[model samples]
Target: MRPLIIFILFYLLCIQVQAKTLQKTVNENTISFDYTWQDHSHKTQTLSFSLPKKLINNKYRRFKRYDKDKAMNHIYKALLEQASSYNPREVRVQFKQQYSQLSYTIKSKSEKKINEVEQKLKQLENKTYLDFLKQHHYIEFNTPWAGTKIKPDHKNFVIEGVDYLEPVTQAIRESISVKKPRVLINFVLSWLQSIPYSTLESRTESSGLGYYPPIRVIAQNIGDCDSKMTLMSAIIKKIYPRLSQSLIYLPQHALIGFQLPTLKTDKYTTINGLHYILAEPVGPAKYPLSEIADSSIGYIDAKSYFHEII
Candidate 1:
């Protein structure tokens, strides 16, 4: 009886473990949607939606803001409609935790149709976002994104508003003196210098990247917190493709992980003997290029930038 019970439990556990697999493949032109949901059994069910670049950030993407089940259903519906146009066999979702990653499957008929629907949804989303952009007309200043003039002499609008551009735009500005990361350092630096700290709100919702460019962060230098973070992150990602999440994310706010070539902040990077440092400039403090790794407030990355309050 004991042997039979053990065998039964083992069989059920195997079925559970095999339910998910690798979610998706990354490419130059791929857009992914990952969200959690509740299955019929009321257990958490995760789904990863990977569609072709035809639709990157579309209207359907906003469903993430709604209820989880609703968002999952919306994505599933779109993928189903898309499958009608092509041939998709399965969709995959990965379950991520502190220690493990597992994936699940969505039976489908066509991959091409999924791409088509995704593109359509992306076009819709872009149109809506663009329309919103057209409605606002002011530059903002908040935190490190501050200091630039709202209406620049050349660009007309600025993000971090300083009267002039800088030699380096990101946290690791000091590193520019020693090494170059293969992209336009000055251009990105100018953007970092252009963030409007004064005009931005203190809070914004985060993206998967742990940054926000909320509506508040946008049009007004505030929107989703992730968008603002993206402004900073985009530069880093452009430079280091395989980098891990920086140790320093924000002041008094715990955010997501991203790639960084150096450990210039209070946060350390376990890479290449720790090559560089940069400040996690978020609020009213000034972080010098040298004191980035200082382990305290008013200092930079040496302290825990992602310390959560709750």
Candidate 2:
């Protein structure tokens, strides 16, 4: 798995007043939200969405922070249970603990027992690790070349987030009042840009301050660059599942790009012979599709950034 590295790139722009047109109404079983933001053309755009109270109250949306030690301990417990199934007289299971790490050793008078335990442990390790990540709504990703990292499970996140966010796309359709592809995308981008910005610490080292799943971005009302990008990707994917997308990572920031026809002035990167028009959803400063922040432009122009397609 490749770890998606994150850097905290700060901008001097003002945090847009997100509460200007915010409205929320709760019923017996659901919470309905309404928000408004100005598009690039200075026209006001409004969208409303409702989510089940039970869904929001569930364990997943409530907890955004990840604990590495706790995860390892969970895996260790599962392995212990698997290893203990064998006869202790012939098979011995040992552990060495140092801080957050837990290492294990399996010994036996019979070489076959050792092999059996080893093989079983391998299976258990993969199973338990995948289970923990899935349960926690996290994904272990690999870098393009060779490396592993952790991030939220983008695919599953999109699948679940799309249901509750259906209204978002619908409202977008209503706001535009037509099926103009470019205007539709820009509308979504501007709306996301209007959301107040939050910072994520080093993604490699920690989940940081405000890395949220797509639903939480709506429920909690804040997200960093990567968090917002993921939410936007999910929304766009729901609208156009066949559209190709990528997550472009810079020194301390992240962006989402779409593969589509482009004008000469549009900023894009070519990957595998496909062109992805880069868009900056991290805002208070609005930019439409085929454009990104000046800072992002620098990294891309220098060929110092990398991307992971979704």
Off by over 4 Å in 1: 1-66, 69-190, 197-220, 223-226, 239-251, 254-276, 281-310
How many clashes show up per model? 68, 11
- Tell me each candidate's TM-score: 0.30, 0.86
The runs of at least 3 residues in candidate 2 whose Cα sits more than 4 Å from the true structure, single-residue gaps closed, are 1-16, 143-147, 302-306
Q: Residue by residue across 1-310, what tens digits does model 1's lDDT show?
A: 6999999999887445433311334567764433332322334434344444433343123322212233334444444454454333353322222322212233336676446555665664445433432333222223343232221011121222221112112323433345554223332322332333442223222112222332223223322323433444444443454544242334333222333353333333332344333433332233322233233434333332331110
Best candidate according to lDDT? 2
Candidate 2 per-residue lDDT, tens place, 35-146, comes to 8778888888788877788877772556565678878899899988877777888898987768988888988888998898889888888898889888887877655433
Instruction: State model 2's lDDT.
Output: 0.78
Q: How many residue pairs in model 2 have overlapping backbones?
A: 11
